[model samples]
Target chain A: MLRELADILQAEELCNTQGDNVQIDIACACDLMSDVLLHAKAQCLLLTGLTTTQSVYTAEVADIKVICFVRGKRPQRDVVELATNKNIILLATHLPMFESCGKLYRNGIKGCSEV
Target chain B: MSEDTTAQVLTAGRVQELVYELKIEDAMVRDVQTVNVESTMDDVRAILREQKISGTPVLCRGELVGIVSIEDLLKALAGGETKTLVREKMSPNVVTLYADEPLVHALNQFARYRYGRFPIIDRKTKKLVGILTKGDIVRCLLRRLEMNHQARERAHYRPGHLFEDVVSDKSTLVLRHRVEGSNFQRAGEASSRLKKNLLSLGLSPDTVRRIAIASYEAEMNIVIFTQGGELVATIEPNQVTIRASDKGPGIPDVELAMQPGYSTAPDWVRELGFGAGMGLPNIKKNTNEMSLDSKVGEGTNLRFTVYTTNPT
Candidate 1:
């Protein structure tokens, strides 16, 4: 499921390969850390356009372990380092937010709010 | 030792740790009742009666001289010396505690001296600061034990079960974290700590998430906009309250700042993914009650509360 999810997003691995085999059935797509905090469920994969260290912190607090930066946004070295330290998986894709969510949805990854 | 005896020893060890960790100032009563050394024994009796306390400290020219107990007053009355000065009847060899000393010292003093109360004094100035009784020590220990119990109950109990046996009239857990302004690396450290504490208290996942989000947003605002600030989360039985305050440049237009997409953040902040103008709006959306007050040149204060039950 993890490899399939990454393949669907056409994401490049940035850090923490240990979660590559973990199952991730839910994905939350958002750019704002605030929205992610408010709506993100635990263990969900976060797809965002923002590539800041705060993004990693938001995921850490929300219990999200994997993040795929959409819109081809590669986070700075510090951001990647923080995610690695927190054991969070990081990925990057050239697709925008809507397309990334669409591709993942088509591949059987459910949205966080879906039943 | 048997399993049961080991468990008893562990509990006793924890209590010992608490006494050493807690300071005398934490258990002492600050508003102490006192009597002037020149005051007559009759004056001490009236104070003990009005304050419903058994003893009062005697002071001379704003300096602690002795302690006058009800027994001292009774002796004065029986000997027909009710009009005698407290300086003559009160015990002059007073035993006092330093405010900064550990509570364990106070406990040892109580056991060794068999005294009813100890007047707490400033270590450097020798000025009386507070009064500590056995009752005060007990109350302080009980309150701390309750907090630790809730944290430990998470392992064996379901969410919300810790509150069922809470007998205290009011119990609150306060968590405070300092946020450094513009420190992107440590922006959400405060909120993360708050979330961890809330989870350990056996709160529902949904409630923890809401508080975490609201606090995270508030923390980000401080890092992005101001010099720095502090985030304090107070968890109560019915609600969780968060206060974020800073001494940075305050908002000039609160009404406009509340808008979903309004922001004054520099382009550099935007590039880091924050300052999306969604910070305040996101906080408002997640919290049940919210308020923000700011003085342009002074500071800003933001307070929000989230209810634990029947959230709408």
Candidate 2:
């Protein structure tokens, strides 16, 4: 399911490739770290435009396993290293947030609130 | 047990421990009002009205003999026996608690025997030492909790004062990180390192997550707002305390800033996917206790504590 979701978004895996076989049924798209902390649940896939180290820390705090940076935003080297050290899967997609979320929703990936 | 029942039990766990820790003498009224055994029912009624008490123990020549209650007095008055002696109407078999017994024993006695009050007696001297009512227990517990809170407040102000009294070898991990203003790239490094350290310390995942979230928000605030600040986390055996202090351009109105949707952040910070005005609220939500102190033209110091023993 994770590999299929990544394909639909045309995302490139940046770190933690072992999580490619993992299943992700719930997804939340947000750039704000506080909103993700407030609303996101554990094991959900995160889609955001922010590619700073804060994003990786937010995912680690909220227990989000995978993060996909939309709008073709690639995080710096240190951010990717941090994600790898945290064992969180990182993906970068060229599609914008709207298109990325739409593609995932079309392929049976439900939003966190919907599920 | 169901989750709800388990939560209820855990919520009452502090009071349960308090009852076992306190002695009956600590909460009992030391000066007990008494009436002589030979006193008449009219005298008992007057004593009850004057003392504002529902019951009084009857003493005979410096010895506790029985207890005269408002119910006994009312019964005598209705039966036209208002002149009856206190001994004639008093219940001779009085249930009493020993002064040295734990307060939990008194609680059990109160639950088992539906009495409104219990006379406490000294075990060695066999003398009535005090009287205990349900009100006394409630007041005692409340006072003790207040004292504990005050002590914790004092410790918070002094930071490491709680560890001073410990002669035994205790490991306290101190983590300090400095932040630079407007540095978005390294905003969460402090909290990230803190999370790893806490996980290595074998703290529960829930507690570690809470501390991490709180510290991350504090760290981001320093990065986005002030000229920079220092975040210090002191990890103890039972709790963790975090202090974030900045240098200049302090907030004028902290109460307004604490609101959920209020933000003074510039457009650049907002463009970085932060400053939605939920950072402080998120910090408050994750930590068990939080305090913010700021003075205009001075600086802001935000401190918070997360209790490991009781994860909220």
Candidate 3:
């Protein structure tokens, strides 16, 4: 499902990670880091549009394994380095928030509530 | 049936006019990835791998010295030469495109040579401004045809429609930014300033964020592509109007360019995380109204407006 999600999002891998073979149970998308920090489910795929290094920091604190930057929002090299050092998988996609979630949902991926 | 032909003829004529008018400067990929002449073969290979590109222009100082391809690297690797510098082995004789040349010149070159890419150098400066590939030409042509049609239809657009033509020169707070082409490091300075001004005016946080993002993305576009330009922000009591105008070729396909992930920026820019093709779309999405006016060879003019809740 991670591999399939990568294809569906046209995602580019930023570093060696837990590997794309891991199944993604829930997906949470938002641009605000505070919202993610407050509400994210553990081990969920975090989708965001903010490219700040703080996004990686927030994800690290929230215990998310994978962070996908949707709408073609590429984070800075320093941010990627931050995520890489923290052992978080970083993926970038050209898909907008609605459609990215739509594709994943249509493919049977669930929201954070299910988790 | 006759009416359809008439509409098609008008569109075709407009497209042809645009094709002849559009030049290479506007659509070429700026912020090119290059290997320094003194760089080691290993360094070149690392750059190629990191950027996911096959070849890159080699530079001595700031001038383009040559172009080195993956084949060059492969041959060197196959011969067990692992430590040679790029200057010793790069192809000195390189083909280049002048920014002022018509778009067809590049199309002909692509058809004739079928080269993967050609470096675009500024005529007076002889400095590398961008790189062009066959894909850029095809993308430009297809997008230009459709966008040119749209541009013609938008000929009568006026920004005053939103502001009721009530702007007073003394009351409007005007800000200007000078953006240098391919200057990635200093891209967001203007946007930062604009954000500060917006916040100082007591605008809502949501409104401030949208305006800041739009201004920053537009500022990035100018920095990433263009021969330096000025961004003018005219702030009124109720709205902030940002107009970005630059020197050089203008955008050929405003619609396609506004699409997310449709970036023509070089891979190196993408490597740094700026060229996601989300700049224009995000700007459009964040603003209440957006308009683009570009001349093929002359330049580009982009204007977007964000309504302020804290209108004083």
lDDT agreement with native, every candidate: 0.86, 0.86, 0.75
For all predicted structures, in order, the TM-scores are: 0.57, 0.57, 0.37
Proportion of true inter-chain contacts also present in candidate 3 = 0.00
Candidate 2: CAPRI quality band: acceptable
Candidate 3 chain B least-lDDT 10 residues: B155-164
Candidate 1 structure quality by residue, lDDT tens digits, B1-312: 543453344348677798889999999999999999999999998999999999999999999999999899889999999999999999998999999999888877876787889999999998999999978987888899898998677555653455656558877767789999988888887888888778767677778888888898899899988889899888788899999999969999999999988989898887776677888888898889999999998899999999896211
Error of 1 at B264 (Å): 1.6
Residue B171 C-alpha lDDT in model 1: 70
lDDT of 2 by residue, B219-240 (tens): 8899888899999998887899
Q: What's candidate 2's DockQ score?
A: 0.39
- In candidate 2, which residue pairs get closer than 3 Å at backbone N, Cα or C atoms, i.e. clash? none
What TM value does the first chain of each candidate achieve?
0.95, 0.96, 0.92
Best by lDDT: 2
**What are the clashing pairs of model 3?**
none
The candidate scoring highest on DockQ is 2
- Could you give candidate 1's per-residue lDDT for residues A1-62 as a string of tens digits? 67787789898889974755788989999876766766678889999888878888899878
DockQ, in order, for the candidates? 0.36, 0.39, 0.02
Give the Cα-based TM-score of candidate 3 against the true structure: 0.37
